[model samples]
Target chain A: MQIFHRSTNTISRATIFGAVFVVAALFWVAATVQRSPYVTYAGVARPQPAPFSHQHHVAGLGIDCRYCHTSVETSSFAGIPPTKTCMNCHSQIWTNAAMLEPVRESYRSGKSLVWNRVNDLPDFVYFNHSIHINKGVGCNTCHGPVDRMPLMYNYASLQMEWCLDCHRAPEKYLRPREQVFNMRYQEPSSSQPVLVDGQPYTDQLSLGMDLVKKYKLRTATDIMSCSTCHR
Target chain B: MRNCRKISLLGALMLLLAGCRQDMHDQPRFKPLAESDFYADLRSARTPVEGTVARGQLHEDTYFYTGKIGNNPGDFMPFPVTEEVLARGRERFDIFCAPCHSRLGDGNGFVPSRGFPRKPPSYHSERLRKAPLGYFFDVISNGFGIMPDYASQIPARDRWCIIAYVRALQLSQNATMADVPSGEKVPSELPRFEEPGSGATLPVVEPKSANSAPEEPK
Candidate 1:
């Protein structure tokens, strides 16, 4: 009877142990399966409505960045041109092209293009484009070499720390505004002539420098604060 | 000992389960007032509240001070057309502008190369060159003609930057090498009048109108 009792006790312990092990294994497998390879949510990997290329627009066309992206000075969005805006050119120009498929689809269907946002900020953060642009932050300083990119990609991480570092010491990132779009700021060994529209870059750089002192905008934080960006 | 352990574990489980039940009736209950003068009469009619704050005013937060952007006309309206402002404008211009308009400020971007319609405007267009500052401001603030409004996307300052850049674009299109600063080397690659990648890749251009070609000057 004693031996039978001991065997029963051992069997009960093994059963509990086996059940615990099974539960743990199942959890591990479920976790592994939940994570997919294609998901790039951590960085700017949201799918865009149409493939937009900065390289084609800036480097190739010489169209001022302001032409399509109108919001740099007044608002936060650097606003994506609406369907009607796209129609302005597409109506007469690329009257029939596959690349303009999305534009046509939206126009014909009367549906607003639900463009997936790439450089999205957290809900709590409040980023204003007017302040930065006014204070002399170039679009390329944060966006990277957009003129070279065929498809728009988030070049800078845009993390809080990254923004703060520049804010802490803007001069490190802030150059004469003429250098704002010049991607290879560090490359040139000697003074290269600056040209705008076809004029000298001297005046433009001088204006940017003067504005920096006038505003007393020392750091990104001075202009960009928790409430400034967070709302 | 085993029974005691089981009882403690069961108690803990019961506590956890109790904590997990959803509670929808957690909000405070209050009776609606019959009269409009609830503020002055609430004390006499019902329980007197301890405090009340005024409503319906603009929330004067940090944005009023730190968030103030653009050319503020009242306080110290230094002309934003200064050299520094223009420089900043140039940087922003290149980042955002050069894509559609070529470096030479001609409207030939990758879109044309891809055979997408809509040729960019030439910076040399007389209308654009003579456009007023406010007109430019309006176009940048609220998109004009083919353009869309930039109010929400770009801040006012950046718009100014683009405007500064636009001036540069205009200058570059019209200026000669002599106009360029002594040290500044003229950009080697002239702006492409033709689309860059369209020659071999895209389909043959078909005439949109029935009579695509203009009647030969007779």
Candidate 2:
């Protein structure tokens, strides 16, 4: 009876230890499985259906950003051009080109080309292009050298600080309308006087500064109001 | 034993906290809708409110007419289209208007080139040719049929600028040496509308007999 009692006690202790180990293992597996996005490491390397060159269209061809991305100047999403827009020229122009295959495929399929977004912000942040563009923020100011980019990538970190810095002081970034797409943001060289139609023209209207002056923003604190960006 | 007791107490406390719900959301409530007098005025305001006194810039007296081609009362109103203003207008027009309206004001623009179903109005059309400068201004300011209001995209000065540019476009296509400023350097090759290869030739419409009546000043 003494031996049986000792055996029972040993069995109970072993069972408790085993149960604890099982629970710990289960907890660890659940934690690992619950890690936010379900995407695998290799999914980051997924290929785009077609290769589109912003540089070729913008800088080389002189097509305005508004031409393709119609909604940039008006809405939240700088909307992608529809397949019909592509087919307009492509039907007669480049019927045989492989790069434009997806465009043709979309035209035939009657489905949108799921172009992957490169410059994605966090879900909470709301950004509008019209307000910024209207306030004299150049395309290059935020989008970087979009005119020169072959496959556009996010140029700015797009972090809150990156945005807040410009909102805090927009004067430094202001340039002539001609220099909207000029990525270097170089001012007119001193040696060469800027002439428009054989007449000397100095840019008197600093749009950003004009706005700041018009609003009479008393302090840096005043300019950085939550509504300026958050809204 | 102590650990078991602690676990039970923790679970019970969590359950008690979760069970304790407030009726804040479902409760009947009444409060003032606005915090300011301005807001109250906005909410309580009636339509056809008395027109506010005009402030800042005063608009020049002008009338806009569509249809028929001929000078009438207040026809060809004089507007000071300075070179600086024209240049600014040209830049804005090139950026905004040139795509759909075309650089020469012909309906055959880049939008049509990209297969947009609706083509813009041609400045060459007699209806537009006879239209007052203010008509074009109004069109750019408030938009015509099927056209979106460009007022938001363009400022008041810029709208005036576009009007000047449109006049320039019309003048370039239709003007003779008499229209050119004397002693002023003119481009040897005046800009002209190129007939689009794919575009069907639209027949010019004749003016109605009613338009021949004596002009009345508005």
TM-score of each: 0.45, 0.48
* Residue-wise C-alpha lDDT for candidate 1, range A1-231, written one tens digit per residue: 455766888899999989999999998986664442222233244566777666655565544556666655667666666677676456656677787898899988756666656565544456777667666576677877667777766666556766777766665444444333333333212243232223232343444444467557754555556665555
The local distance difference test score of model 1 is 0.55
What level of docking quality does candidate 2 show? incorrect
- Tell me the lDDT of model 1 at B179: 91
- Candidate 2 TM-score, true structure as reference: 0.48
Q: Which residue pairs collide, candidate 2?
A: none
The segments of candidate 2 whose C-alpha lies over 4 angstroms from its true place after superposition are: A1-47, A176-185, A192-211, A214-219, B1-167, B188-218
Local accuracy of candidate 2 as per-residue lDDT tens digits, B1-218: 99999999999999977855544322333211211235433222233436654565344433422211333333343447788778877766765687667768897766555544567789988888887766666677666665655654565667677777887888789988888888876774332222322111111122223334221100
DockQ of 2: 0.03
lDDT of 2 by residue, A137-173 (tens): 6787777777667876666766667777876786656
Angstrom error at residue B104, model 2: 5.4
